[model samples]
Target: MHSLGFEPNEITYGSVLSACTAFQVPIFGKQVYSLAMKNGFFSNGYVRAGMIDLFSKNCSFEDALRVFHDVFCENVVCWNAIISGAVKNGENRVALDLFHEMCCGSFLPNSYTFSSILGACAALEELDVGKGVQGWVIKCGAGDVFVETAIVDLYAKCGLMGEAVEEFLQMPIRNVVSWTTVISGFVQTDDSTCALKFFKDMRELGVEINNYTVTSVVTACAKLAMIEEAIQVHSWILKAGFYSDAAVGAALINMYSKIGEFDLSMLVFKDVGSLKNPVVWVAMISASAQNQNPGEALEIFRKMLQESLRLDKFCISSLLSVIGCLNLGRQIHCYTLKTGLVSDVSVGSALLTTYSKSGSLEESHKVFEQILERDNVSWASMIAGFAEHGCADQAIKLFGEMLLEEIVPDQMTLTATLTACSALRSLQKGKEIHGYALRIGVGKDVVVGGALVTMYSKCGTLELAKSVFDMLPQKDQVARSSLISGYAQNGYIEKALMLFFDMLMADLAIDSFTVSSVLGAIALLNRSDIGTQMHALIAKMGLDSDISVGSSLVTMYSKCGSIEECRKAFDQIEKPDLIGWTAMIVSYAQHGKGTEALRLYDLMRKEGIKPDSVTFVGVLSACSHNGLVEEAYIHLNSMAKDHGIEPGYRHYACMIDLLGRSGRLKEAESFINDIPIKPDALVWGTLLAACKVHGDIELGKLAAKKVMELEPCDAGAYVSFSNICADVGQWEEVLKIRSLMKGTGVKKEPGWSFV
Candidate 1:
């Protein structure tokens, strides 16, 4: 019209501005605004409302407000437009303020005004404000389907699902939006059964479902783990021609994965046929990882990269979850950095976790430090990394810093910090955290409760641990296992066994850790009969082949004097890892079958399993028991040369015992002196015990002196020295040793036998 030289009027400008707002053409809308201003159309309410909406929808809130103030007379259309625009711009509080100001003036709120204001209340989760708005909605007689749906949404978002449902039932006419709102509300509130029931009612009522409804139904099925319901929902989605919807497809993929139907998730992925949809790809990748198909997840990620799909934070986080090696993790981390996605907290936290899991704490810390906006997840991941890697001090310190920064610790953060406290045996810190947990209202949370039990157990406060366990509202597997393990660790073996029996009687799920803890208790009791029964249960439960369970069985049988059964259990492990191999070797060593232990160690090496420090301890113990001095020397050298494992104090003690058994007393003393690290009291005490066995009076005196120097209050050292003096007829020295023990207030510990 302008090109044809037709002068634009207020009506024409208003129509064009509405078109601009509809198309989201803010630049063109600005030009139209100038034309409307030049034509003096700002006085027209239609043009003014259109301009406010155009600017507000396009994130030009200042311009929208300017236009609102430019008009001399305030009208309801302009008021609704400005308030709705404020909401669209994410200025929820501003929208509320504008609504209050409009209410104090001449204009009363309409249905459209109520809808927008209720949306602001929903966004803010302001239940009180929403209730007030609902009252106003009724008093003004502005309650329509749109306003009612918004009210339902406000109640739902505020977690008042009962009120939302009650309001929904009162609606004389409900649309698809109303049904979807209530159904999705149930899903959001974690009432998946109610969500499913509502969906059923909707379908029976012949209410049409949209993609969001289908997505919500799928989520509900996933949460319930109702695979049949999920399948039915999938079929309905297909029939409704909503199968290609990205959100619905993602929800279906996640639902299938949650129900352990990875194949179905893959089928949905293939059928979606829209690789461009990042949500679908992310869901598939996450599903594969969640189902423990990391290789497949990585393969899907590679295909995603091949398709030139832009990687979002969720996509990056999902891909990071599947990374099994430091190299792969670094590759993804580098990709995130180049894409500037590393700045995203989710991606950064995922990279931190990936690096930590791959055994690169330095890289994990680096990523954590580089996260510009660290949330609870980033802090929790780093703390867990430090705890898992035995950097307990660092984890605790980081947790303290997190608190000082006033970042509220979530359940994972608290759990990880408790784990760090467990590892460090920091009882005071643990108790403080427990108090903090109660203060924050998560003390009764199951995960945190389990961590508390483990923490108190590890700190040797079994009573406190048991108290926490008893206070738990619902004891799950983790809490039960933690309490059981705590009992075993703190010498409350009978209590551990009783709890295991209670779990069995209750038919609670018995995982490998629970069985392992029970086996450990049985091992301490040397109850082969109980161990045998446990083995039977293990086989019945199809857990005999689990590596952790197998290791526990080996230790239990070995301690119970069932070496033959230990060997059989070891053989049952389909592919024994390092822990399994080490357990068998240690079991054989304990049984004095040193040659058998050596042979098994060789077999372990042949199977390409590299030995760790504990493996070497078992190897050295076998040599020590067998008096294989030459073999001990060779293995000790190989520990540093071949495996890059430094021989710890236990290895040194074993070597010294081997030399002393061979009557190479001089060689043993030289070995202790030559140890690169200072031998602790255990190493010296081992030598003193050897001297007592050999009746080497002079060497015994020197070894006892060293042990006393390293541990002055050790009554065992004093007793051993006194016994050595008595054997050599050194009466004067024996008397002096007894006097020294009296002066130091040392007393020999009474010996006991498990049998």
Candidate 2:
């Protein structure tokens, strides 16, 4: 067209310059600008507007402003170009400043100008400013097609769904983009039902759904786990032939990942072939991590490295998602070391998480210390890293150091530090951390707020936990679950139920975590009615698939003496993880089905599901409760010698109880002595109960003696010794046990049956 030599004018030069800007050919645009200047076309407002558009499009807003300043004939278009350029480049503050300058310069902002300013206001979270701009847009009588869409987007981003809806309804014309913006807003608020309804309404109105439309609605579906709707959206994507568009591909990837459809997510990722967008990579990585399939995330990361892309901050953040898989985590650390990505704070933090989760606290510390300057986030991350790895003291010290440095700890930092406090049972120190957290507005953080509730509850400060829980303006599932569990943990079963019902009133969805929390309350009450209602709720929600929820259900039923229900739930689980298997086996053990518990334990081993410490605790308990003397010893030996469990206190307690109950009193004593480590009061109590059952007064006395050393004034131990002495007709010994309990300044708690 240029070769035709038909004298090119302002529009022609503008189009050509815009093309150069789009392609980021700044040198070529500059050459054209110089040519336009020599021809005196720079004086033309249209030509100057084109130059501004070119620079802005190229993400060079400064260059755009330079062109605007040189224009002899400044107009509304030139000002709009400059303002729009700032918005496009994410220089929102600058865009707002320039808009103010334009308003004062006697050039009234047009509809497009108002839209750009609204975008800047939205980004700045200046909702009032956005409303003011909207008013001007209306007063100017330019509330047209493009303006309506822009306003919708601005309000949607600002979380003003009601106002966004009002704008959409009042608009003379509503397009697919405008509707999509509204749907996205609802999705952001987790109001998927509203989003779905709006999408249906758009379709009924004969709105032509494009890739963005489908992508927008798919987000709502994913949030609600609306599988059918998501699949339908996926089908529409195929029909629109938008499978190739990165936005469509990313939305599909995110949807599948959210719906527990990792296979489909991978299929989308592979079909997308080479994801160029770092956001797409993050979606895939986060999906894999969220689904507990870190291996796929790792594989994707490797493929990502092969592309013509450098791992950015998000790439490292994505890696952090899969640190639960220790081996892969270490591999990532090594990969980071090789690729020089360790210098980046995001990658460094991810590496720290990987090392910490893998029990390599020292390595995590090494990486953490390598960072010369740390942000509050970095300090929080290190504190969390230390706490998760059981380096409680270090976690506490780091939190203190963060304070000394005047880095006001956020919720994450305080929560992690409090977790360390809980692990150490440092109520005094935890209170101090809580005090600091309160001063800094830490309660706004869901996890820290929830952790504060649990920490105080665990530390036996129920009132303090109540205070924190009461102060939260909004309590999501995590917060509610934490508060409920804390209540149940502190024996406030009724309070837990009250909170659970309050959550329903708040319309918060009862997820697996919520059910699991209620299960704790059920366990505390041991009430069949509450347990049955909870089970019904679980069934209604189809949360039987959730391992934690399933485990909790089994536990609740087991404790409520509904062993048959526990068995049914256990049997229905398709592929029981160790926790599930342990829960079921423990249920059987609690119900006195020792052989059945042992059978499940064997089945677990046969399935290559190696039993963890909790698994062994149940197995040992089965043997101890049912007096399976030989079986207990065999399992104990297997746990230590074969499985390398190195029996914990509970395991030893199980062994001692098994021996003592079967009249092998001497064997019980020997077993306690032979444990790799010293046992706690629970171990001695188990043996003392067994002695009381067998009328072994001497052995009972010995067990009671050990209990007093472990727990200086154990009322149960005193009762057990007194009972054994009475059974053997030793009245004087019983009186001595009572007198000794009193002399220790011990106050025995009254036993009250729950149900």
* All-Cα superposition RMSD per candidate: 6.3, 7.7
Candidate 1 structure quality by residue, lDDT tens digits, 1-755: 89999999878888999899899898998899888878787588888888988898876788899989876646788898999989987789899999999888888788999999999999999999999999988888889999999999999998899999999999988999999999989988989889989999998999988888888888899854587777887888888889878888888889988888888889999988474787888788888878877777777767777888888787788767766757767877888888998877789999999989977899899999989878888999999999999899999999989989999999999999999999999999999999999999999999999999999999999999989999999899999999999899889999999999999999999999999999999999888888888889999999999999999998888888888998999999878999999999998998899999999999999999999999999999999889888988999999999989989999999998888888888889999889999989988888888899999888888889888988889999999989998987899999999999999888887899758
Q: Local error of candidate 2 at 201, Å?
A: 12
lDDT of candidate 2 over 1-755, digit per residue (tens)? 65776767888778888888778898898988787787778787777887888888865677787787774446787888888889987879899988888888878788889878887887877888888888888788888877887888788888888988998898888777788888888888788889989988987889877777777777887844588888887887788688878777888888988778889998888777574876677678878888887777777777777775566666676767554877777776776777777766677777777777777888888988876566666788888888877788989988888888877776677778989998887899988887777777665567777888778877878888778877877666776787788788878899889999988787788877878888879887879888888777777788887888888878888888999988887775667788899999988888889889989888888999888889998998898778777777788788878878777787787787778768888877887887778778988898888888888887788889989898986778888888889988999988888898889887779889746
Write down the worst ten-residue block by lDDT for model 2: 308-317
How far residue 27's Cα lies from its native spot in candidate 1, in Å, is 13
Quick one: how many clashes does candidate 1 have? 0
**Top of the candidates by TM-score:** 1
lDDT accuracy of residue 413 in candidate 2: 75
